[model samples]
Target: MDTTRRQALTLALASAAFPAASASAAPRPTGVEGQRRADLGDGRFLNPVLAGDRPDPNVLKDGRDYYATFSSFQYYPGVPIWHSRDLVNWTPVTAALKTNIGNVWALDIAKHNGRYFIYIPVLVDGDRPLRTYVIHADSMKGPWSEPIDMRIDNMIDPGHAVGEDGKRYLFFNGGNRVRISDDGLSATGKIEHVYGGWPIPQDWIIEGFALEGPKVLRKDGWFYLFSGQGGTAGPPTSHMVVVARSRSIDGPWENCPHNPIVRTARRDEPWWSRGHATAIEGPDGKWWLVYHGYENGFRTLGRQMLLEPIEWTADGWPRALGGDLSRPMPKPRGGSGGAHGLALSGFSPDMFGTKLAFQAPRGNDYLDRVKLAGGVLTLKGQGSGPADASPLVFVAGDRSYEVTVEAEIEGDTAAGLVLFYNEKLFCGLGLGPERLHAYRIGQEERWPPGAPIDARRLHLKLVNDENVVTFFHSRDGRQWTKERSFEVAGYNHNVADGFLSLRPGIYAAGSGSARFANLTYRARGPSA
Candidate 1:
């Protein structure tokens, strides 16, 4: 611990976790009606028990129920199963990979024996090669079962184990290990490197030496493993959570003398590049961990899902009692609480729910080009803008929000509302019955005087407030117009590379059809 005394105890723990957001104040982050509710209803709780861009979180539990899932990168309804009993409320259960196949990352979600699996790790794009897939389910609200590509290449974080001679393994992401076939879908060999991680201190400021998320956990007789070391997004104390154990899953492991058991060490911590973790068991039995971070300056809200509380130690090891979470605590005791999120107020236009599904960063085959009847929704045009229009997004874990919709156009479609982040970055406001385009960092400006949206229905509104967005439209919902505002904190993933998160979505694009209507959303509050 000497890089000038660990940078002076990381600036005294970032001046006690309360001095980082400053460019005049900055630090809004609150959520509930627009989602981001980490309980806090009297019994206390808060620390993203799942919020925007939930990265690498993979919880399982089954039995008093708990299920979680994240890292849905290109987002196509990919890996979305959430549901909780008392792991601090949660909802949405369904979307077990409706085929997009690429860019998805860190998943695991096991159930075993009675069945229910999900391994995934795609990343395809460009120089190709990087695979690992598997999906299965006898029930977790899913018929789930199409992936199966375990052709296992370059690896990216799998971690599903079951040994003590029961066989079946998956481990991976540098410490490697494979051989899993017995109904858990393919791969039954090749890929063993077996444990070499946990050794970080050489000047320590880190963001490299990327060990990657492993998450094994067997308990009692011991198999443990839990990983992710640095580099899961750069320095705010680059990612942590480490541990190692092994009474026998076959190995000489053993490294948790309280090793990194959860980190963030400072940057005015309110969660920031925390770690990958995943160690569950708590419906009353206690012991938790489940991780992912980055909320400090709201890394555009990308690495969320947090939940802490861990104990163990009487020589055994586990520790991370949840500090740096910034506030509220006590809430995970005896299960039984359900219904936690979803209802970004579409203001009843026949209300669709699951936050108004439209997903397509790649496939769902455009749901046969969409239609949605009654409360409108239309769609049909395609790539002429917003990076090849695949818009329909929704996973807005609030940090100030507003969204609105209406749009109508029919023959030369343009359709509106966007915030998107993947068809090569995004920006919003579209309208086309005459003109009003805007999109920003990903191009498409056109509004030089703009006033003609001469009816094909109108009304647009975006308003992020925290990220400073603005832009409005309206034609009859009472006449309004603003037009542009922009800011969006560079639209995330460090100037957009893909671990996405900026979504707000809706897009039609070129030639013939576009409907959308009423839409709504709401939230507008915290961001500092």
Candidate 2:
């Protein structure tokens, strides 16, 4: 076929896979402007109970309250705990991992012996030779213990379960299992293959048969192993949830008659690759499934956590209630969480005191490198560029928000605000000693010659109006010039494969130091 024909065919497929929003329609509200809330306020809640990059959900039911956490890859202060009582409304409780362990993936949060534990498997800086680690806390709002490397090799997701025999075990991808110690801190027995996951049809168009993320639930004299298959993120149709049941936790697992309890059969669905679910009994004793998926055309938001009701058949099988989940359903009955989600507005009176966390650093030294005093944040520059500089970053869950910061470089340093996803993918406008620097898709691009850069102090602003980021700069706080604009819907795990979220942050690169001030964060429009 000719190049033109091939390109046209590709475009057709792309359009079929992801339907574009109508041009004449009003802009859909994203990020926290009373939009994307799972609680619909009419006793009907939406599918995505929690939105924005919350993947590999592990939900634990503790008394009347429910605690949940996601796989926070490469984000320091990882595994943020969220609390919800009604299961529809959630609020961020606290971040558990303060120190960087690595790129965390498919973690399991469980309470064994009245103590909270998060079983983590990470790539250790996105390198090969994966390892599993465990962290524990006395309280959910922790004082979480430092990560203790379990040293388990070649594992991605660790699903913790206690057998009827009262022994703890972790089920992994590729139908593997390993025994855990009595304290749930270390692996005990040899890793062995136990249950072969439910087989996907050979003709199915899937990314891969990578059966992973086995969340085990033991109830009614049966051990239900819920596993995700067809790869995590690739084609929109890839990734799904399949269930297998067994009388004994050891062996002889049978696939569910209604296999694939949840899946994105079509590419055009609102939520794609819907899998990795944690089946939990809601506060009212009704069973529900919480999973993650990429919002259609908004992959940069990462896989937002989704909640759907489930029903059990008389013959002992679970079925998902809400279909495709493009709309709202009845809210979960019973208790209510105090509030759901965080306020996106971070603008404070004092810019120097802004809550900041460095990107995944090699060590704990980044804290010492940052100093705040007299309304200025002095950060020592590091790395050849932003990818390794460990730019100070914070999580913003809004779909449309603007952030601005005034930065002054000391010596050879170049510093400015950025919309960063990870080391591999990011874009923004910055200033150096000589000229303006533009970063796109993890690489620095040449700017137009003769852009003004005489003044040492530069004010940089990033307006992310629903993934469309516009860059602006100003010498004085009053006058601003638009530098550039770029759409960043692809800077997420589906394209970059980092399982990360697009975040607004500040970075200092090259030698010397950079002083940043007047940092402000405010949510913008889907104008009414």
Best by TM-score: 2
- Kindly give the number of clashing pairs for every candidate: 3, 1
Candidate 2 root-mean-square deviation in Å: 9.3
Top candidate on lDDT is 2
Worst 10-residue lDDT window for candidate 2 reads 9-18
Angstrom error of the Cα, residue 39, model 2: value is 2.4
Q: What is candidate 1's CA lDDT for residue 372?
A: 59
lDDT of each: 0.73, 0.76
Task: Provide the lDDT at 43 for model 1.
Answer: 75
- Which residue pairs show collisions in model 1? 27-528, 28-527, 28-528
Pairs clashing within candidate 2: 31-399
lDDT of 1 by residue, 1-528 (tens): 011111000000011111221222222222223265677667777767767777888888888888888877666667777789888788876778777777778888888779888898898865656888888879988778888787888888898898898888898887888887877788878888889889889887877878888988888888889898888876788889899998998788888976898888878777778888888989888898988887877677688788889999888889988878776789888887666764331223212223444445546575667765543557788878767877777766667767665667689777788887776667887877777777877788755473564656666777786678877876554457786788887788867666777878788878787876555555645442
TM-score of model 2 relative to the true fold? 0.87
